[model samples]
Target: MKILALNGSPRMKASSTYHILAPFLAGMKAAGAEVELIHIRRLNLEVCIGCYTCWARTPGVCIHDDSMADVLQKFNTADMVIFGTPLYHFSMSGIMKTFIDRLLPRFEPWLIPHPHVPGVTGHPERVQKPYKMFLVSPGGFPEFEHFDSLVATFKQMARMENWEYTGEILRPGAEPLSRRSLQNLFTGYYTLLRQAGEELIRDGRISDNLQLQLREDLFPGGKEVFYQLAEGYWTEQMDKFKVPQEQRHTVPLLAKDLDSTPMAPAGSNITNDTSKTGDRYYVSNEVIMQTMTAMYDTKAAPNLQATIQFQIIPPKIDFDPGEAMWYLEINGARCDLHQGKTAIPTLSITTPYEVWYDIGIGNVDALEAFTNGDYEATGSQKLLNDMLHLFPRPEPGSDDPLAAELDTLMMGMPTAFNPEAAKGTNAVIQFILSGKGGGLYFLNIAEGKCTVQRGAAKNPTMTIHCPAETWLAISTGKLDGHQAFMQEKYRVSGDMAILLKFNTMFDTHTN
Candidate 1:
């Protein structure tokens, strides 16, 4: 089958419309369909003048000398045509509308009765050929309702042109698909698009179930969260461009003045304070508790079953009762919060309310606060370390480094440790890394808990010796661990069984 795809986004390859269209065409090509993609922005096509020269003066031939002739030739021969565009003003973009208007040469001037629908008159096609028409569009809005008018227009066009109206692929809240940090959340959506394309080629149509899945949100959060993130993104952009507050709607004339401007790093200015009528109000303990309960990430630790108790001490400000106690019960992806403490908690944190509030609002780093003795954690240290991973904070700035030094990476092992994989395991692993940023560190794993310390371990179950750079690359997924081992880039001594369980034991690559 031959397919022709027209991309009508002004941004061309950078547009979200192309992000969705590229994968679909890839899947079609993989399914043995010949595909041709054309970008309307790159074409030298003019707007239709409504001169009727194509219909009156000459039959089925346009008067304009431009790229539309080539497009028409390809459109006439293709078995299927895909129109990819970004939604503008509740309809297709202006460029797309212009492209559609230029196709008038393909239709005869005479009006005729609709072939399938009753009581409907439409223009007859100049050329009689069976083909399929599909629409692929992405909108900035967060509701599927925004695409209703566009979809209706396409359906009507298909009816008038005597083409099969294949199902459309519509994506709402599509801006996030272009963000590198959030790409993982849309992996399933991209895969679904590929499946839709393959199904259209092999099965003649996408399954009803798959179509429903395609319309689901790209991420788990609702529309409210999407709006918040979008607002944050635009605000950052405005600040980056140095647009004045009064002229925010207008584009800035000059480039960003980096030397004179002071910009806050992404994810650094989040706070829980609100101001109304010049009166400042801090978040109450109840609000904090509710936010924590809502922030639980079930997918991150699906098999984790534990209880965490928070004991908030008195604060300097006037808060009713000044102190509070709360406990969170986590059982295999489910988490419930209670007002009071549980009888037995796997981990208990005791800290001043102010300190806890600072950490909650991202004003202070949680790990740094813990290391500085601002908070006291008792019971299982492993649980204390895994708290951030279980309920991860909002993503850090995109500029954050993907890799860290040996000390920082070693100390973060507990966060990536898989307790389920290391059940009933007790071992000591020693690492003597050489080179810059290297140090001597050892990990003690016992009773499904992991702890790291700076020193050599006596009678170690497994000892690894390697250059720090090589280990860092392996841990951060820059190099394959198994391949590095085979190439003798790193040497392991004693306890070959423990070495074999390294990948399953700790997910260091995620760090």
Candidate 2:
């Protein structure tokens, strides 16, 4: 298949629309399709003057001598045409709209009903063979309803032109590609896009399920997160404009009229905007333990008689490597939790309490935490992998009652609990977790006391990046940290030898 994509975003290579299309192009190439992407903004495109000269002076060719001629040639030769754009005022960008108008020369002014067609619909007169058209549009808002008008226009245009409308890829929350926090959500979305492209080439259509997934929220936090991100971006832009803080909240130049315009109350189907500022929300540990217990009771848990014991310890003096520990034991289909050390533990997990706090709140992906070296496990890899699945995944920004409950489980509270671990120590370590559910964390140890903070550390003795889940397994003694490091599951910087002293500095006493 030969595919030609017209990128209408003014941002061109930097646009979210292009970011979405890149993976699709890769998938198409994998499926043996020849693809060409053209950034429309780079071309010298002029608005249509409604000159009718193409109809009267020259047939099937525009009279205006410009870049449109080249665009027309590409359009006529493509087996499938993809129109990619960002939503502007509930429709396509001005450039894209003009590009559609310039397509007029390809169709004769006369419209007549097809003799063999059962529907008896009028069609535009064209010289080339019929081709399929697909739409790719990504909006910053979280609602698909914002695309209703734009999609309807394309459907109508396809009908009038007697062309096939293969499908549309409309995604909301398009800012995830640029935000570190939304990396996990964005990964799932891009994977779906790649799969959709492959199916489109092999089966001539994207599966319905893939289309549904494409429209799903890119952030688990839903509409509120979407608008919150938007506000933050706008605020940053406002700062660049040198606007005063008092005037910062005023309506934007483009939105002033709309804000003043009288409008009817929104319909029941409308999802109201909820972008109010508040503390960061996360799932609670209590909810996570309860969910795990429920999963253990179900078929998800294995029925093994042999006991597999695991210990979880924080980097605190009270949690000294050998004295203080939280033991969680798995026997048969039951799971038991107890405080203090286990004489002979199967595995032990060691990390700062904040890392576990992020995992419990569903802010960090367990696997990412492992790969990032957020935690280390010291036991059997097989059992560690199995036990990891015992925990349920919380839906990001889901509207389900349970999801909503988890979102606000502990609305306002501190998650980190290591106040004395840094005492007598003088080192700073930064952990950068990747993949889904991973974020930056900083551990500052000074004068033997330790304090943890989110984001980067000022100056660090050592830095680590790993997967969250694997880190958890390694921390719990389920997976060997040395083996993981050797296998390239994580990377380190600064003084590598300092990492070996972490046990003594943080009091990670092995059983």
Candidate 3:
């Protein structure tokens, strides 16, 4: 069998989308199938101008003379066509979409009932030989909803072309799993995705079980750990580029208006006593339970099912030892926060409460704590990682008024809200942050100007809701907003078209 994999990511070598395909391609090659990998961005392809030239003037060919013409031939000759892309705006990337559009020439303009299948639905009839269609996409988010539109488009395309829909591989949390330490965690996933390819080559289709596994969260460590790791990455990037906190948050509407930046967030007032000795803000059992109940967003991780037991040691803990032992069970969409223990829990973690407190407040380095014998996991490390978000850190420092006002502190930062991207646009965008430190804010932009307000919009064009920590991470370039949206960390309901201005509206890096 001959396979053509068209990679649409512009990142090229740095793309996590491309990397996931490595094992799959290797599996196919090992199975004795000839595979050709092509990066679409590398080709000099022109966007389709919606002209009927391809259909009316010259059939089976786009009007523009570009490298896509050769790509078209390869696509036609391949026994199977694999569309590989990084999910963008709940769909394929612009380059890949354009490639799909250009392929319109290979089908008749008029629609009819699918020739091969007897269905009431009508689709553009294919003029060339049929080839099985498969999609390999990696979404940054952990939610399956991110692939909703992309999956629909591909399935429809397959039906329209009268080709069998082989299956898809939608790997969420692609970035987090790509981390060096976490790469080993995906050893089974890598083997499975590659095995999927082998199955395709040998059986002419991918296994259903493997397809389901591909769509599972690539980083089972959950969103909290993922965000922490992401933040470290963004911090490094900021330092590498020497991006000032002011500019990092500034969204210049006009290049000329760079000097008129908004006021940035103030520095933290709580000073850290570097000395690791302190039981002043010691975390109690109640605090842990309240924090979990307040912060856990069932919508963000709807299908995460696991039972975790926390075993706290004495001296480090102030609460009753019996109360210190807690169990958190997340079944389906419900989370049952139970105090005490379970007979056969999915996972158990034993640690000093002091170390746990420090880890919670970002004071203790988890790896170091583990290395220093502060904590130990008696069950699956993966489960412990997945449940880490349930124990979010309290605001840094003592539980004082200043700690509660951390969200407001972040509000003062230059949010990089580019009004220029909305130069000829007008919209009211609402930001509803949940969790312990969340708040509601709105950005009203029109006529190349933006007004930031502390309350909700009366009639908003779009409303984005997420945990406060997630937004903070995105603002700092530690977590990508696009990725967050895909991962279900944030849900957007309203005019999604306005979000397309994200990149054009703000420069993520400093000059």
Instruction: For candidate 1, list the clashing residue pairs, or say none.
Output: none
Q: What are the root-mean-square deviations of the candidates from the true structure over C-alphas?
A: 24.9, 25.9, 25.6
Candidate order, TM-score descending: 1, 3, 2
Each candidate structure's TM-score, on Cα atoms with residue i matched to residue i, is 0.48, 0.46, 0.46
- The candidate scoring highest on TM-score is 1
Off by over 4 Å in 1: 243-511
User: Model 2's lDDT to the true fold?
Assistant: 0.63
What C-alpha lDDT, on a 0 to 100 scale, does residue 317 get in candidate 2? 28
Predicted structure with the largest lDDT when compared to the true one: 1
lDDT values for all models: 0.75, 0.63, 0.67
lDDT of 3: 0.67
Q: Write model 2 residue lDDT over 1-511, tens digit each, in one string.
A: 8999989999888788898898988888889999999899888888789987777788777867889999888888899999998999899998899889888888776656753355666546666578889999988777789999999998877766666899899876675564545556577778888998899999999998888777777766767766787899889867676635643332232332122222222231212122322222222323223223332322345553222333343333222223234555565555665554444344445544445545643566666666666666554444455554554433233444433332232121113223364345577776554333444455776665566665444456887655555554555566777788888666676777667766545433211
Candidate 1 per-residue lDDT over residues 373-399, each given as its tens digit: 677776666666677766543322224
Candidate 3 clashes between residue pairs 3 or more apart in a chain or in different chains: 141-487, 142-487, 249-414, 249-416, 250-416, 251-416, 253-420, 264-412, 265-412, 265-413
